[model samples]
Target: MLSWVQKRGTSEHRTGLETPLQGPKQRCWFVWDPMGIIFAIATWALVLSGAWVLVRDLLIPSNNVFYAIANGVVFHLLASLALVSHLRTMLTDPGSVPLGNPPGPDTVSYCPFCLCAIPERVYHCTVCRRCIRKNDHHCPWVNNCVGEDNQKYFLLFTLYVGLMSTHVLLLLAIPVLRSHARGEWNASSTVSLPGPIFFLFLVALMGFIFALVMLCSQMCSIYKDKTTTEMLHQNKHSQGRQSMWANIKAICGPRVSLAWLSPFHSPDRYKVSERHVMA
Candidate 1:
């Protein structure tokens, strides 16, 4: 009876859907994540709306508004370009090169979730559930993984976006500040003067400023040929000593901008050679 019971239990476990067991490997090119998509859309919307307002106000021949708008648009465009470039690299790059023929030994290590072999300087993103080539941390706002391909673009995006947002805030503030100085409103004035719009503008300004500062700091580290992981490790060991500017210049090189835009350096291009890696 004990043997029968044991066999019954084994059979039941095998048939149970809740039981954890390894299944056949399934290959898929793209996996959709709705939350990620939504986040990306929202960020893009903010950028577009800000650009529209700046352009519209400038066209009205309102004091320095055009200059402010142009500055804001340029900055945001640069930043967005950087981020998009980085994200594109990550998505296209194959995780690893498969062993030819009989496949005796697995030459590369891979994360189970993403099913991609880890590349040199790459890391696994827990949130995105993928092994990114030259992986940087996942960016929540962009809803995309940052890796070797898109890193430069991502950096550009951060820098420009920050500059644009800050410029807009200042431009908007000048008129209000000037009016306030002239005692335009009473102390208890309840009159609506685009207050809600201004409040939203302030919120966006603050948010972008914080994001820009953080991204710029990270970009400085990356330019030094260091990952956030490596930076933290070095900091812990060396009491927060940062990499020198010379080191960063060496890694980034003189033609960094050209290299950044070239698709040859992109992770999506399977032909990426060691020459593409920064020193």
Candidate 2:
């Protein structure tokens, strides 16, 4: 892929998006765009920076060994899960249709950009330069498109990030709240947050807000049997059966299990027999 990009050079207008694939490429799913790569790196940098500051300024300095150890363990665990989920979402194939695949039963129209016939709910991601099945949207944060194949990882990413952020915020806030309750803090008491702590607070707050909004949106999309792209385009015709639980199971897995919460687990594969077209 890198060699292919180098051959095309950067001066080309659309580069990857406009150029149709001449042949079937290997299954590596990384996006080669500069912006996406930078954003992905920044995401890791911020997560690591927050962890370092939290450990240095908040967790290690605590007087109680048990308190520090417990919080540190929980925070690191959640952080690890969030990062792993993000990596999985970024690297996993998001159900890309075969390049230049011949028209079939589900074919709606040919994508000029990808030179392939795409089915219902399929959309072309310019960044990824592929027609993704049930493409939701291209997220620079994860540096990939969210679609049928990897929505579970995207959801898990948001969930774990939200939990970790909330945990950090609560740890930073509770002491102040307790002090105010005990009358140790007053309007003129002039308690101020240190620079590093303030920076950590901002990071946690941003992560929490972003994760909460995204998680809620993804949940609603799943329940309605739609993608973010479908919602935005107002494509309301149902592509599959309308059972909420069934849709959830389809994205998360075949059955309810702890694996649903795991980034290591892949979602149940979508079988053609399980899908039907409306007449």
Candidate 3:
């Protein structure tokens, strides 16, 4: 395949990524990997189930209508943001280099598996079946590779999830604390929670911890201007990179603002070329 690609004339290579099958493929961003699909489904199931339990068991039954309305609104808003961020992360293309692309002046190597020229900071993801620019580790939870284009959405997903989890934990704890303070509740006064409420507590606790840890790791990576893959492999080439704020801007957007927090906004610093598929 390498030989065939190499033997092709410049004009053939110049045709770029366009081909008969490219259009349909470009329209779909879903990865077909079984484990990724399963994890994605599980993620949606967890979010939906937890939200239902929170609303039906915890929020609706509250004695204070104002409290119930306020908490419910906040929880749903955070949950909606988290879900939107997850969808954007999964559906956005992660800056995959055009397959079978011709080597350029800055090309550092070639990916034999992909039969494409590999540029600096590019790594091939076997699961993605392509070379991704600034490729980070693939995330099963989001069912996508965290790479150049989609990193912003992934960060926002973690942030909102962590915030939502914290909110849930507070809602569960405050009432119990208040009862105890008034001497109306004690260890002997404690009663078992309903099944759905119990389930919600467990989910919130687990989600909080997971999101907290992942968010911290991702923030550190952004600060250091190194991806998880580069750090793990000890890629020396990543040294002498831009400063922390510059690196953050590069990934999130050109300027630091509320837009950086939005999953609907694309980073202006790195636009995908026409030759690249948006899949």
Candidate 4:
């Protein structure tokens, strides 16, 4: 709800944001933001590295047009989706607390720093320097606070990345099998695979394992209608399926199936207002 205002008598709109002198709910940034840069560099490095290996060894050299094209299509598609989602998550406003608004009947609390009505599930992120609606943990890798507005994007990014890693691993298997069948590959020769081939296999495996663990953890939190922050403190609930699904719809939007692959908004999503249970 907090929108930036322009400086009076100036044609330029105020650019840099400053946290007001509110309580702990607001904080002035003291250091440079390094997360976004690190995340972007790491993401592209892995993706490009994997693509080079796959196309050079498996996709192109295989001389199978259909296989190459199909794998290329799927791989690049996932990478694009993942990259786009990551950007969306990083750049999006993570549901700010409405400033100077009186609390409604259901809103009984206030953010100490922002002095805004506190709805259920909203919390303050010191790193982000604001109170976020339905606040999830501030993810360093994405370089953003995961909140109601961008949680879906965060999850979709994770899903696509995990799939990308797994798919690359599958692609790596072909050459590995051939080498093994011909008795040309041995444990000692693990170091002898082409540089790209070895790098792709190792990176893919590590990526898949890391993403799988993170994905499973996130899924559990979503299923229970809880965030990792809440889960860390042992938050538990016995909400009905409908309630849980409502949380899903909140994050995944209405068209759950299409939502994962695309960034289009569905009609049903508009009807849903922002809401979150306090941690």
Q: What's the TM-score of each model vs. the native? A: 0.58, 0.89, 0.85, 0.74
Q: Which ranges in model 2 have alpha carbons more than 4 Å from their true place?
A: 1-25, 275-279
Model 3, stretches more than 4 Å misplaced?
A: 1-25, 185-191, 271-279
lDDT of 4 at 15: 35
lDDT of 4 at 157: 78
Between prediction 2 and prediction 3, the one with superior TM-score is 2
Ranking by TM-score: 2, 3, 4, 1
Residue 264 of model 2 has an lDDT of 89
- Which stretch of 10 consecutive residues in model 4 shows the poorest summed lDDT? 4-13
Which candidate's lDDT is highest? 2
Candidate 1 clash pair list: 79-156, 79-157, 80-157, 82-153, 82-154, 83-153, 83-154, 85-150, 86-150, 86-151
Question: Who wins the TM-score comparison?
Answer: 2
TM-score of 3: 0.85
Which of 3 and 4 is the better model by lDDT?
3
TM-score winner between 2 and 4, please give it: 2
Query: Alpha carbon lDDT of residue 186, candidate 1?
Result: 80
Q: Report the C-alpha lDDT of model 3 over 50-69, residue by residue, as the tens digit.
A: 98898888888877799888
Poorest stretch of ten by lDDT in candidate 1: 98-107
Tell me the lDDT of candidate 4. Answer: 0.67
Clashes of each: 10, 0, 0, 5
